[model samples]
Target: MPSQPPDSSKPKPRYTLDEGAPGAFEGETVTRRKFMTGGAMAIGGVATAAFGLPALGFALGPQFEDGTPDRWQDMGPEGEFSVSTYVPKVMNLVADAGEAGKHTVYIRKFDPKRDSKRNADLPYVAISNRCAHLGCPVRYIQASKRFVCPCHGGVYEFEGKVAGGPPVRPLDRFYTRVRGGRVEVGERFSLNSELRRFSVRDPSNHLDGPWQYLYPSRPST
Candidate 1:
């Protein structure tokens, strides 16, 4: 019977990264220059995101040069307006200025120069829905054939000229036209010259002029 003796001649293998280039594992930390470069890149990226892009947009994009907003896009076409029915709309005079500068105008089907007869010849005319007296909204009353302002009981005819009440003048009008089967209204402006001259001057002070704004000199209620 023969017994085999134990053999322990092989040395233990050192752990190494597979397929790595020589001297790649000489140091655990990255180079200082590389670390500084990475830090600088991160800071620069943050700075660019935080401030640079917005400043660039302010410089290159649309700037408010004269503090006045741009002209608003038109609400096109006046032909689509229905006859004798007052349709409410918002007219933008300036872009991006919001609702304050814009006006609430009403367009109805009627002839421009015709008087307020039920059987008038033309179709519709546009009028400012804002009450001439206190800048209140006016509603169309078919039964009375007039636009009635719920506030202070101002009344306007179909032509938007004032019929009665605290309103000193007619409702404001828009620059309106017909185009391509639609009724288009341009940016809001002051009332037509004739209406301004003869209409109620001021709702707040009706006796003075047709153009005065009501509540301007009135005592606080």
Candidate 2:
């Protein structure tokens, strides 16, 4: 018998856009490209958070917290310092571990004839060796009765008042107390322009002085 004609009613093989199209999803629901992109975005977010959190904490953590308070440190007998002279003394600060750190300060016992004698409580002045201009160590010139910065030409009188050169303000004054014939020093406080002028006989009174706008009236803690 002759073979019958092939059946024309048979359904043709169906072809869908999902089957062989480029960028098509595997299961018609979630595409491989979309899954990979989402995973990458999640990882990137996690990495950003890991680095950003610590930096944010470091900046804002101590804004409201009360920091450590400064305490008095002894600097030997009050008699050791003489009138109209700068006595260099080394002091150690409290540290976390091991030995404390050493720092130097200039102490001046004002002459009895000076106005500083009017206040018996403030008979002497203690100034930090650090220069106001660039934090350089200032040396005392006994002959000139001034402290001079070797790095710069910053000159300060015996009262720690800036007399000339690059220093913006006077040397920082340490809070001093004479207890049991021993001199004790404490936290440092910056002097305002008015107080700085009080210590000098002929202060630079110009509003547009060299260091007029260099530093703030009060130093930040």
Candidate 3:
């Protein structure tokens, strides 16, 4: 057989860019390599949005919504609490929908004449049972008139002042009001500044003294 020469008459492969087109590869017909790359990129973007959208919503959703309300709950009649003694009470906190949760509080009713320095008008005091050191439940010692945390050696005075050990500040106290012979408890506030001194005149101040360094300014959810 005779050897044939290369067919120079055959049409060579051609590539051209199309005008007025849309997309990352706009204006150009993509090659197999370019098409595969673009497909992978599109899949990656969809996957990222699938996982990222929910995570973003979870982190920032609470910030945009209305915060927890400060609703005063009726504990009971004032007569239920004995004078000069700590009484433990557990109450379920109500939220926007229904019951949020329950918390334990130590309520003390003081005699008006015994401690004139203490607020005579507000004779009732309600303190949180959660310890300031590490969020442990503190036990009240009637003999010593102090709260002792078993987790650590933290101790707090009857007035919720930090008496000893590792507690950065005193136990938090509830805002209280007496109306129609009933005791109403509201939001809890920490004794940040006033924990250093034992005085009813100075109450909890979140922005004062060493509280910024010692403990978190706000409670973690």
Candidate 4:
């Protein structure tokens, strides 16, 4: 039994690099295995942080503010809007919680002549500047008395009814109200079915006060 305790002084095996003469490693060598393990743990920690923060934000982020339209929007007084002309007025719409900046809507004020003859009760008809076909901005041509699309040469009458082009649908009209003689137009909807198919008279052979009277100013509110 005493003879078995004689081999207690034997040295343990040492790990070494490829260019080993006698194994120069002391405590723990800066090995590739240790570095890879640490790198993997660090990457896993970063991934956990990336996914966890958004989940927390989703559960506890700020609530969205309401989106009701403001009542006191700026549209010039009734006198400033002429009777027969479509005057485009630009207004800034406030941004929502998700939006960055205010959105601008081009609201048109129908002149007295057009409003009195066609839309006596309602004086304003707000239509979007965009054309129905290619989403191009429609400009009112005073000489031709039509809304013309610059992109593809689409023509629309005074009431936003399509006169000629590849467009099958007419332009949209907004809901308007005159409060304290200030014309306020809400969001625009689709053009009325009757207005969409309306035909404009040929001005070359007309015999009246003016050819503009034939076109309707207001499309159903």
Candidate 5:
């Protein structure tokens, strides 16, 4: 059997009354009870959002917050660090938190022969000990010459590039400069697999390709 086409010339029923609905009156598109219920629901949703949205934002807003300092931190004399191996040093990440704010940073002299040519101008390589997977502390294993996260199996090569497990990107790095004969570590930044520098991102945030767009860099980065 052939299907019939819809009638475009016929006018649509604009009111419940026109559709012969029970408890409907002239010029009524909906019953009074339904209209009241819909209006009440709309008002309730707006009221809920007014209170809920702000609380939700307050809870999650810190993830996007930018509070990193611009001032450079003194690591030590340039002789303390070498080009071959990473030397771990403790530094304050959060201000005024005492011992709790201290974090471990690995520093080494920049070797132009072994490191990326793009970073040849850098005075030293300062890497954050935080794993890219979870915020777990990673220790540099001299035997394997790799950074291993104890919380997970996330592993990074000597250059901090992810070599295995669930890490999204490489370990973070800090800008280094020589001032007053001491090595000073500047702003913390992130890196891609190719060793390209990017704004600092949280653990598990990807900084390669389109994924980098999702975790947009904050101002503090």
Candidate 6:
């Protein structure tokens, strides 16, 4: 093969104006369009992080936060509750909310004969009227001995275990204690299908099976 002589070629312009870029200012290295695009992207990223980080914190922060409530609320004297049946009592759940905090709680004397052994340590069985399915108020029917949700027809047995409908686990319960001569309700706790107690969870959160692994309990629970 025969050797060819070297050829000279023009290099790409360093400045946008020198390269005839549209709307490019004199001596500009980057075009206005490129600058705007980069700025827009940076702004968008910041905006996304502003919204996204809080939401992520709201979702995951509970897992790290320490301290669980040791507060107790006295509902009534010990003489009122009976081992045979549940009694409806108005309780102030939200502190400092006055009348607005009033929520109906079902309380009964713990019965060793019929009640499960796992929860017999509780002096009284205090159950929340909030439905395990969607937090609709449930009314206990004396005739049927069942708690029935009017909104979703979620039914729970006398022991607060899910009997029917969309409830994921047993109805939530609170720790009970005898303070002086009155009955007191302590921090709320959730239960598994087998009536095993766990930390309080929001409605529709399950405590058993694969759902337990998927949605583990948070520290603030």
CA displacement after TM-score superposition, residue 67 of candidate 1 (Å): 22
Cα lDDT, model 1, residue 13: 29
Residues 1-221, model 5: lDDT tens digits: 99988577988689999877898899888888888999999999999999988766644554566535477889999989888899998888776889987888999999888888766667899899989888799999989989999998999999888999999889998888899989988777888888887767888888777676567565443
Given candidate 3, what's the lDDT at residue 31?
A: 59
| lDDT (C-alpha, whole model) for all candidates | 0.54, 0.64, 0.65, 0.55, 0.84, 0.84
> What would the per-residue lDDT of candidate 4 be over residues 1-221, giving only the tens digit for each residue?
55665355765335444325253455545556666899999999999999988765543331231222344455777776654557776654333423432333344565555432444344577666667676666887767767888888888887677799855455655556788877776544443324421221221212123322333222222
> How do the residues 57-138 of candidate 1 rate in per-residue lDDT, one tens digit apiece?
5443322223222332345456545665666767764456687657666777665445444324223355667676777778
Query: Candidate 1: where are CA atoms >4 Å away?
Result: 1-79, 99-102, 110-124, 189-221
Candidate 6 residue-wise lDDT, 1-221, digit = tens: 98875444767789998878888888899987888999999999999999988767755653464424488888899999998889998877777889977788899999999999999889899999989898899998989999999988899999999999998888888889998999999777788898987667778898786565445454443
Model 2 global lDDT (CA atoms, 0 to 1) = 0.64
lDDT value, residue 4 of candidate 1: 69
Backbone clash total, candidate 6: 0
Q: Backbone clash tally for model 4?
A: 6
Off by over 4 Å in 4: 1-72, 93-121, 196-221
The superposed Cα distance between candidate 3 and the true structure at residue 130, in angstroms, equals 0.6
Candidate 6, position 11, lDDT: 72
What does the lDDT come to for candidate 1?
0.54
RMSD, each candidate, Å? 21.3, 14.5, 12.7, 17.6, 7.0, 6.8
Error of 3 at 191 (Å): 0.8
Worst 10 residues of 1 by lDDT: 212-221
